[model samples]
Target: MASPLEEKTVARLVAAATAAPSMHNAQPWRFRFLTGERVVLLHADLERAMPRSDPDNRALHIGCGAALFNLRVASVHAGLAPRTRLVPEPEDPLLLAAVHLAGPAERAPDPDLARLYPAIRQRHTSRHPFADKDVPEDVRATLREAAAREGAELLFPGPWHADTVLELVRDAESRDVMDPAANEDLVRWTRLGPEADTAVDGVPEYAFGPRKRDGKAPVRDFTGRRPVADRGSTSFERTAHLALLSTPGDGPADWLRAGQALERVLLEATLADLATSLTSHALEDRDLRLLARDPGSGTGQVQMVLRLGYGPRGPATPRRPVADVLDVV
Candidate 1:
């Protein structure tokens, strides 16, 4: 039987995991705490999957990765050492991970990770423009290291590459906007005003930054089809610091690893007081995805496109309650 303290620790971890960001805040994960075995099982909630945007389950894996990171941090805070086995059961496809809790390890918590735990609740994806200030080279290095520690590569593309990627994003935006089915699917998940209160999933109107009336580089317009009145306009950064997250392989396991690394990098950036947003537009297109890979290196597969800089924080998106996501049995 698990001790009372152990049970409490598991509960706390669930709370932390729920705070993780999801694509459109879908929160598409469920947890089962096995007290007798001192293990926590993470499963994907297929019902919450975004079929239109994440048909291949990339974003879903990314969301789960964010939750997994939270669980790890919660374990640290609760004085437990979490040893995780990713995709422990292939037979059960929904089962993503089995985290076995061991008693506290002697090693101190990772100072960088510990510093980011508080920011987990504070970090928001900023769509508004970043100031003209360039992100220092040292900060970029730190962020790169953060991603590396989690089995992902963070590459800052040169201006020419960035421009190429930007054009691809514009293509994606144009396609998504013109396709009625795609727009409809996005509209279904978006919530506004009173609808926001009832929505357990989807992006809230407040979280959608203002619509650009003029020509601005494409940011995923969550509000493209359904306009949100009173959305304020702001000048976007002319020069954005863009980084790509990549993995050595492209499989379910690789995706899970990349997802974990993505959150680690994001949290680290958050702790550094940087605002971040992600675009997988280019990666979503097969030709563009192939182009993203460095032909000579032959090792990395692009997992995400991240934009990082200093900017005003966006509003906090909603999450389902801890009780809703965690099962005591």
Candidate 2:
């Protein structure tokens, strides 16, 4: 028989899982611990889904997958091997993943996952400007290896390709301005004024970073052109260090794999003392996604565009309480 997992241990793992980044900091995931089975079920909270921005729920699934990855890491760090089964029940669509914590005999943690534990909290989506310095070739290789380990590809685009991706972001930003529905998510998930200080979920105004007075970093302007109190405007990096993450196919499973790869790369970047941010806005549109892919290597579907550099890390955003997102069953 499996040993009974402690409530405190389960809570710690859930807290670490919640720290994973989400689109607009929505943090759209819930956890249910099956004490008898030594398993935890990860479910997507559809209520947090962005109907306008992420209509097909791809981003939602990616966010939940990220949380699931974190849980595995936390479990390993706590001296338990996490044997995860993705989409364990297709009939129950909300159930995105189920992780079985290995019992006493099989509880040796994976050193790889355990080493990344400290970076879970350190990783943040830095929307601010980054320096013009290029990421060293060695670091680039390390990041690529990290993604490959999780069954995804990470490409540091060459100048010409990077410019093409940048243009796609510009086009997406322009479209966002004219499309009324597109702004719905930004409004719903952004916290302003005093709400920024107290709200437990959503991107606070302070975390919005500075407005793009100039330059092209592809950071989304969450203020929706309404002007934020005490917000400043500054020029971003003219040549933002951008990396594209892709998978062999475009399906729910591929998206989950991409998410795990995404977190792995982010944690490695954080450990390397690099600041990072994500921009899925450009990939929101189907046409834009097609354009965002590498012209030379047109094989995989692009899932996320990451901005990396040396700069001040972002402030810790709020997350829902563990009780709010977990249940003991």
Candidate 3:
């Protein structure tokens, strides 16, 4: 077999990697390619970290982990076996992962990874209200499997559990309102008016969807007492379809795994024609996070709360240029 990786192939992989979601669209990741070794390195861009909101840098690591997952998928799609190592260097905390591009005698993509290639670009976070409808059990099973592949659990909470989780989100929202440090992060990461039109990062005004006029979805109100012209109000779904992504341990490694699982489940949901939005707000706090977990099972740390249904898929947000995030050697 010939060389499995070239500059162009690596560039394509990096593009897909850059598309992964970050907390508040911070997009905190950097990539380096060692052509001699055919290894791609993932690093955390500390400059993009939300110091106030993500004090522990858990969200930052999750974002980088998501990017690493995309690289794996993209590599497979390009007929190369991707061998990934998370936190390969304990001495270098910023180095999140290293992926080797292997050229085997038979060069072919993993069927499952290749299957998700199309959904990578199709999946977007939909902040708008979803139509009140039930997601089929088969689809739920697919999502669960996706999470399982990345060593995480996807749980569709019961009605009582969902209510409790929503309450925790509300409590979190109140905390944000009261905490100036929290507001600082939102204000830093949200773009309004003309700023949203040209910004390369941060949540744009158009992507925020309509202000919640009614209903209880754990969607964060990014505006947060700020005013935006033409931002109208709309009623969200009454019974929001909520799924929690969790891992047995809560640490940098687990956060990375959670992020990979998150993107996998998201791609699966998109393929199932389900619109999705994420809520890490509730799980930001330690006490609130515990309250958000499964009362019955009482295991694992909830990484993200995803609300999925049929709705308008969110508009594509901007990302830093490929050259900005990648360095090829």
The parts of candidate 2 lying over 4 Å away from their true place are none
What order do candidates take by TM-score, descending? 2, 3, 1
Q: Pick the lDDT winner.
A: 2
lDDT values, one for every candidate: 0.78, 0.91, 0.89
**Residue-level error in angstroms, candidate 2, position 198:** 0.8
Kindly provide the TM-score of model 1 when superposed on the true structure, using C-alpha atoms: 0.93
Between 1 and 2, whose lDDT is larger? 2
- Residue pairs with colliding backbones in model 1 are 129-236
- Local accuracy of candidate 3 as per-residue lDDT tens digits, 113-197: 9889898898888889999999999999999999999999999999999999998888888887787777898899999999999
Listed in order, each prediction's TM-score against the native is 0.93, 0.98, 0.97
* Tens-digit lDDT track of model 2 for 1-329: 76799998999999999999899999989999999999999998999999898988889888888898899899988888899998889899899899999954776678999999999999888888898888999999999999999899999999999999998988888998888878998899999998999999999998988888998788988888677877888988988899999999888778888889999999999999999999998899988899888899787999999999999788889999999999988
Mind giving the per-residue lDDT tens digits that candidate 1 earns over 48-135? 8877777888778878987998888777767666778999989998999998766654345544555667877877887777766778
RMSD of each: 2.2, 1.0, 1.3
**At residue 200, what lDDT does model 3 achieve?**
95
Cα error, residue 198 of model 3, in Å, equals: 1.3
